[model samples]
Target: MNNKEKADEYFSKNKSKIKDSDRPVYHFTPDIGWMNDPNGFSYFNGEYHLFYQYNPYDIKWGPMHWGHAKTRDFVNWDRLPVALAPDDEIKGQCFSGTAITDNDKHILVYTVHSNDKEEQTVEIGDGVNYKAVSDKPVIGIDKLPKGFGGVDFRDPKIWKEDNVYYCIASAKNDRGFGSILLFESKDLLEWKYVGILFENDGKYGKMWECPDFFKLGNKYVLVISVMGMQARKRKYFNGHQVIYFVGTYDKSSYKFIPNGRGKTFDFGFDFYAPQSLYAGGRTLSVAWLHDWSNDLTLDGAKWCGQTTFPRELKLEGNDIYQMPAGELESHYKNKYHTSFILNRNKEYIDNDLNSRTARFDFDIENIDADKLTLFLAANDEYNSFIKINMKKKTLKFSRRFSGLCKDAIDERKIDIDICDGQLSLSVLVDRFSIEIFVNKGKEVLTSRIYTPLDANEIRFLADGKLKIDVSKNEIE
Candidate 1:
């Protein structure tokens, strides 16, 4: 049997080995083994298809396969068969890529990592199965100009303009800096290299990966993940982080002029390789919600890693604001609401407001308060908490006391500004992770935590006075 067919068979046979309780209650974890980096996020066959980097052999990453799953709504997922496996090109493995749909055809453009070289490859399928368009790479090292390196060239994001297909890929120059290279194809078969779209200024990072280019609202935004960046104060806390540039792309000249400094969509420990697709008239995004430098998944947990809750991306001017997809609201149950004016140096704890699988949203107006803190998954001695300091204009999220990962990253902070002493915060807590949106998603933070499942206590504390409106929605 072929590699893809064999992978599907082995996955089906071995998936039953993992206990159902080992998986997250609401996030999509493949039936068995390790998964990372959401790929081929596209709307196909009237369903949202999200394929990811998979290695079904164990809960740790190994040789790569394209794992497939689909949903009519982003909340309910159905696992499909394994899509692509290592091809017979000197131990080649499939890496990150994107997908697009035209009529009845579903096309996948991905990177093939073989030997010491990385190249772009293509496949055609009808959502259930796929085959490579060519026996050889469609765009390879030869396509890059004089100064680019082949080792770091990967992650192609494609779009069609006036019947011509264009692609952007992440590559490194001879200076060891990352560059986003552009290419074009008449058909999907062969491609011609366009010039570099944007190059790193040596300050963003060493190598940039997972390039996604598209227009949002009135301007185009180019998103990429950076590697080898040291933490700079409150930004880029992880060794790798995701960032984007708001700019304009000139189709005639194949150039992108960035408006200002590069900005990040998230400021948390475990977010990388974000991919965004335009479907159903809105921009939807997902990313590998785990960091490579840290592996804190519980010991003997038969699976590892999941995508961040899918978010809807909206752009106003140059800033991109994201919130949980609207589809998530339909999956919530046990709705609870509470409103109270909390006095200075006081604590408020509610039994109905705490859950591992729930959503908490708070709207607060400062009444002589300098600090507001909300603790989640809390018991008397353990908890993960978010602290907002209006006096210092800062927000911090930490799981340091959650009784896991003593040596790994446990806290993240971001600078914030409260307008008119008003703040809107939304927190989504799954069994293993939490997402925080601030000021209607003008800023966001996402990370994974592994606390005791029974530590489901919610508490609010203030350093001074505050007016609060809060609600909890149990996610089913």
Candidate 2:
């Protein structure tokens, strides 16, 4: 049988084994096996297609294939057949890359990583069915630019500019530093090297994995996931983390001049390798919502890994703000609103505000408290809390007591400026993830939790009296 037939058979056999309790209601999780590094997030033929690194037979990472899903509004998703698989003759894995709509065909550009040679080769495919345009690499190791000699090249992100296609791929320099290489293609078949776009000066990390470059408003943004960086004094733990550089791109010279130091894309523990697509006149991005250090408890669960809710990227000054895609508001229902004042040393637990999937909007003013806390996914044994300190102007997410599977990186904190002594926040809670938007998305945090499925209580606490207006909406 062909690769498509094999994938269909494997998915059919294991799809029934997935535990319903472990799956997310709104987030995109594979029907079976393991998934990571969201690849090819793009819109083609009136549908949004999302592909990822997939292994169909197990809950752990293995032989890679491109798992596929499509959505019309970014809320409801349809899992399609697997798109790409490693050919028998390739003797390697199909790694991460991007997709684009070219000449009415879905073009997939990805890396064929061969562990035997410790090198990578680029390949492209056409149509929804990924038939390789060529069996050999269009751009190989011999074509790489100078100063880049490491074997860590992968994850090509492609975009079109004034009828010419540009590709930015992650690479490693001869000295083991992370870098991004630029390539230009006219017909999506042959590619020419266009100098190095940017590289780490030893301050970021050793190797970069996924690199995405795009224009948000007037400035150009480059997002990448860096590996082997230390976690000391950072919001994320030591391992793979995603960061973005806001800068200006000189299209004439193909040069990128960053404005300042790169900033953390998501001030959370579980976001990485985010890829964006231009849809509905906005840039929407999704990421792998699992961390590297967490232990997998997949003894009976047939599937693992999920993608974050699609976020709309907006640029305000040098900072990027992420809000849930506007289409997602259609899924919200059962709106509840309340206003209250919590005195010092008081804790309010709202048992009625129970939902495994919900959206919360909080407008807090008249601040007389040093600290304010909100608990979500709360139950008798598990709960995650978002703590905000007025004096320090910081927000911290703590999941230490949320459930089992304890790790040292269960908590993440970041400093933010509270605007006008008031806090406006929005929180989206899915089954296994929580996305917190603080001060109208000025600073956003995305976290993944393993709390119990029945943990649906909401609680509020304060150190002193404060007035707040809270609204909750259950998402269908």
Candidate 3:
């Protein structure tokens, strides 16, 4: 059978295995099998299209296809059919890439990986139907950098600037160092190699994956997912971390002058290979919410992997601020509110705040506490805690006691300042994940936790007196 016939039969036979109770209400997950690394995120014909690496036959990663979905708003999604599948000639997989709209045609540029060579290919389609633009790669392996082998050449992020199409792809040199290659094309069918856009300075990582370059505000931002970098002191972890560099782009010379060392894009354990699109005058992004280390927990479920909530990216100074995007308030209901003052060494419990899927907004003032702790997804058997230290200006998330999972990363901490003795926090909890936006997205944390399905309680404790106003919205 052909590749399309195989995908159709796989979907028809295994579609019933997916269970609604195991899926998240607000996040985008595959209906069956496994998904990872969001791809081809673009706004086309008044709708947002999101594609990802998918394996339709099982809950584990395997041969990859382009799984497709679209949404009018970022909150609600409609899953489409599989967009692209592996061909017999490729005999490997279709990896991650991006999409672009040129005049009237929608085009997809992606990497095809096999055992011997990695090549770049293209496809054309509307939102529903797509066809391969060419049987051969537009940018073939012979066209890559001379000294560098084609092992790590993949993930082409394409965009247009001044009527010229630009593509940036990740690669590793013969010396086993990571770099990003740049290419320019007058038309989408042909391309010429530009020089290396950016390379690691020996401190970053051995190989780079998923390189995205675009202009945000007056500065250009480059986002890369790095592999094989050792964990630094209080910064990124030991493997597969996404980082971004804010800099100036000289369009005349096609060179990037970065301001400083890149910063960690997200401080959570679950975010990686995020792709962004410019839509409605904003740079919006979404990421695969599970990392390589946490993939073992989803073995029993029929479906695995999910995307993080869409975030609006804003550049402030040298840093980027990310917040929940596109009117999230519309999905939340059953409002609850309260105000209280917590004395030293006291605890407050509100049964009304309990929910499996809820949004919590806290406004804290006149803080005199050395530390404050909030427990979520709590029951007699399991709980996850978020601890805030006012004096040290640090926040920590701990899931050590969160039930049903072991041998995963349990703690993540970040240094965040309290402004004018005040803190504003917004927490979104789904069935198996928690996303915390601290001080209005100045510092954010996204993590996954596995608790008893019945654990639905909220608790707050403080070391000193503080006035707090809290609101809860249960999301359907």
Candidate 4:
């Protein structure tokens, strides 16, 4: 079958297996279909607006549309109409872009992906990337300025500074170095090139997707997810990731100070393709939590990817920390678990083993043990383990569950240590992704592990006398 036919077939098989939970601790496949890079994230007029790459025609990834949703509060989301669909001459799809309110009116600017049936790469000046509509494409390639390497550019993220609109998009150079193209637009329409941000000088690996620029505390941060790098060569590599550099932006020179190397936003296997929007005096970021490499689960799970909960990015002495938005606590049902202690080393004996979709805040005061392993979905032979290696002062996590068809048995490891007076963690597990927020979102580890549709057994254990209070919250 052709690409379209294969996509439709994939969608039909996993339609029922897809999970779109309304509760706060659940997973959701977008109402329409495939979704990628979170776009146009803004809180306007007392409402939270979120748009993502969507393919309504099928469940599989393809030419995207701006799938839209809004909420008075983050809890109760209302799926709105498809904000931007393919209405332009760009043949293949609407790739990805950001949106902003242009003078009290909601206006969207996105990268339009056009693939000629005969040509592998179409010239941006020849025809591609214009405004799009649901029924048809908008504008023509001829309307754009006639210069710059065009086909390798898209994913526009526009922001305003000192009354001027600035956008940063991803592009490749004539020498094959991946870089960000900068543009200046006064009325959101016509544009002028404003020097490339960081040239693909072979230092940053390769192509950057969903480039975003914002200010946090005293530092200006440039964040982008890079692709085509391997795990051993990089710090964290599942597929793409949200990596960034902190520097100073000079408006007069229109340049960013080259800082040190970029760092991974979250040291997790699942987090990637992250984008950010600045509002409410804080910079909030979100990312797709599934890998583009080794995409073996897409056929079995139906839905392809998921996004981490909104995080507030803060810079503390040259290091970036991600904390979940405080407003999310409003969705907690207040149902918490108190009494909790450890018994045997192999099996969990006490505490609460109920409520599959919930949150856990754990505080351990004192504990003596060679190893402390907490189980999330534990059974006779297989279980997901979050082990604290007291000997190494490290916490390692890995998972094993129902569907085990993938090549690797599906495991992840990270070095996390306790801080301050205690260590805190917030766990959110849907059917697919397990997001661990360590120490009040200071350190987050996101992973995609396939568990049986019904594997919901959780327990905890410590090597010695473990004094800890675990609060489990059920969300409405």
Candidate 5:
């Protein structure tokens, strides 16, 4: 079947298995299609609005459009009509962009694709960037930029500080180094080209997708997800990773002072395309929780893509730590189960599948082994599976689906390790993605995997010798 058909079939088979359809956990996949990039995240009039890159046409990847959804409490979401869809003149479709509220209007600046129509040739003009205005998106494709480089030059991130709007976009150079192009707008219409903020020096990767620029505390954080970067020292994959550079931004020169070097935000097998928004007094981040290299079972179930939990970011000394947002605790009303331990061994514990969603915690201290493995099953015996292995100082994950009658476990991995003192790991396993935070976001691992929802089994194993405390919280 085609991708649309496949997605429909997949959603039909597994929609019921999704956790808290009425109230969503920080981790869950789009019900029928694909979603990426957290957009238009703002709390206005006591409501939280979240827009994203969505392609409803397929369970797998395809032409992307702006998908809209909102929540009053950030837990129960109501899907709204798509904010932006590609009109005929646009070549392939809508590309990534950001949404900002200006005065009364919600101004959205996005890159529109005309690549397919404009043949790939130097002779052809660059692609176009447009402004999507919505008092209801009725006006449609309000304003566009003058030289667009096909669809490749897309994903606009917009922000305003003193009333003037600024945007940063991802562009590929002739030599293929991913770069960020800067622009300034007065009325959110006409944009003046500013100098390039940063570019890949063959250090990180080729293409930088979803570049988010924001201020945290007294420092600036430039977050970008890239594809095709080799590990300089430590990393699991040869392609696709998210890295960040924490520095100070000088608006006068429009340059950022490098505090040190760039590093991977999460040292896991999966985690890419992270976007941050300043909410309350803290800067909260949510990322697309899947990688290009791993299969999300979209082929079998047809639905795909997931978002990591809201992480509260803070600048600690010279490093940043990400912890689950405090608001997320509101979901713990039901409290199906909880576990705690000061010290332990092969402490294998299991809890009833009381609720569809859960928050699992492990406090680990004392390390003597070269490797450690923690497995979760629906039962105490055999079969049902979700395995997390810390081998050679790397964190790895694997799982088996309930529908697929395969004895072989499908391995979907994210590698991360702890530093200095004791390490605490929190895992949120929904229908699709597994969002793991190590040592309170020192290294996070977000991977999209498909497993039987009913397979509510959890197991813990240590390779050598270590002390671990475990707790599981089910959503009310």
Candidate 6:
């Protein structure tokens, strides 16, 4: 059998070793092995299919393959078979890319990582198994423009406008920085270069990767994950960051002109390489719920990495507001809501609202306080907290007490704007992750926690009076 067949057999046999209790309830992960950077999120066969960078032989990243999963709604997922594998003939692994629907056939254009150079190739399949359209690379090293090299040319983001197809991939030019080169194709196999879409100005980061260019509302947005950024301020905290640029894709000139600057896509500790899909009149997205780290979850659960909960994105005044996919409401079991005045030096603990797998939507309408803190995923032995400071206009999230990790990141702080002395916070707590949306996605924070599953407690503490209304729902 070939490498693809061998991979499929290996995953089919090994996935049974993992239990459902070991995985996140509402998030997507690999069947049994390592999963990273979501690739090819598109609608086909009446369902949404997400392809991810997969390594099935072990619980850590290795020779890359494409793992597949499908969902009609965003919350519930049906794991599909391993889609693509490194070919023994090509002697490379499949990297990252996007997909598009072509006349009932799902077409994937992705990068193949070889010994030295990376190249672009095509694959076509039904929702289950995919094969290469051609054994040879379409955009090989010879076709690259002057100053463009082969190794960094990967993560092809493709979209269709009118009858022509457009694709962009990140490449490091001779200038020693990153540039996004645009190309167009009449057919899926052949492509022609169309100038640069956007190039790095040297201030953002180094090589940009996993780019997504799409239209949201009346504005065109370009999303990219950058490498080699240093953490000097509130932004670029990850060093490797996922950021977005609001601009116009001048179809006439085939160039993107930014309005001003790029903004942080997610102000969380663990978010990168996110891709967006425009489906059903909504712009939906999901990112790898991880950052660049040598110490992942391989030693802990024999399973590593997860995808952020799918979000519905919208453009409201050059800012993207993300709402958890509406399909999640079907999983709510026991929901309790309360409105109260939390005075200074008072602590409020709700037994009914404490759950690891739950959702809390709380609004702090009237604030007369210097500080507010919420302890979540808490018990006597372990607790994680989000502390908001009114004078500092900042919020800090830390998971150091949730579990012990000497090497991995445990905390992050971001600038928060509380308009009119009011703040709305939506917290989605899973068995191993916490997703917080501030003021309906004005600023969002996502982090992974390793606390014991039984440590499910929610407590509120404040320094001064505040009017709060909280709605808690148990979501599996």
List per-candidate RMSD values in Å.
1.3, 1.8, 1.5, 5.7, 6.8, 1.4
Residue pairs that clash (backbone atoms under 3 angstroms), model 6 = none
Q: How do the candidates rank by lDDT, highest first?
A: 1, 6, 3, 2, 4, 5
Report the C-alpha lDDT of model 6 over 254-373, residue by residue, as the tens digit: 799988778888877788999999888999999999888536474557578899988999998788888788888988988899888888989988788789998899888656788898
RMSD of 2: 1.8
Model 3 gets an lDDT of 0.85
Q: Which stretches of candidate 3 lie over 4 Å from their true place?
A: none
> Residue 46's C-alpha lDDT in candidate 2?
85
Over 1-476, each residue of candidate 4 has an lDDT whose tens digit, in order, gives 54334434544554565455422244434654567777777766667677778775655777677666776545566766565555434456657767666555555667767653110111111011223233232222332233435566767777777777787777755665567767776755455666767655565656777788888888888887777654543255545666778888887767877467777777666777677767777788877766666454545334455577777888876677887666667877757677555554656544344555666667765455556777775555545667776556566667654354576425655556665325667777555666787766656777776655455666677777566677777555
lDDT of 2 by residue, 3-118 (tens): 65697799988677777666887788888888988998988878899999999888898888889888887677788888878767555688999988876778787888777332
Task: Give TM-scores for every candidate, taking all chains together and pairing residue i with residue i.
Answer: 0.97, 0.96, 0.97, 0.83, 0.79, 0.97
Over all chains combined, what TM-score does candidate 5 have? 0.79
Worst 10 residues of 3 by lDDT: 292-301
Candidate-wise lDDT, in order: 0.87, 0.82, 0.85, 0.62, 0.61, 0.85
Model 4 RMSD in Å is: 5.7
TM-score of model 1 vs. true structure = 0.97
lDDT of 4: 0.62
User: Which residue segments of model 2 deviate by more than 4 Å?
Assistant: 19-21, 117-127, 232-237, 406-408
Q: Arrange candidates by TM-score, highest first: which order?
A: 1, 6, 3, 2, 4, 5
Worst 10 residues of 1 by lDDT: 229-238
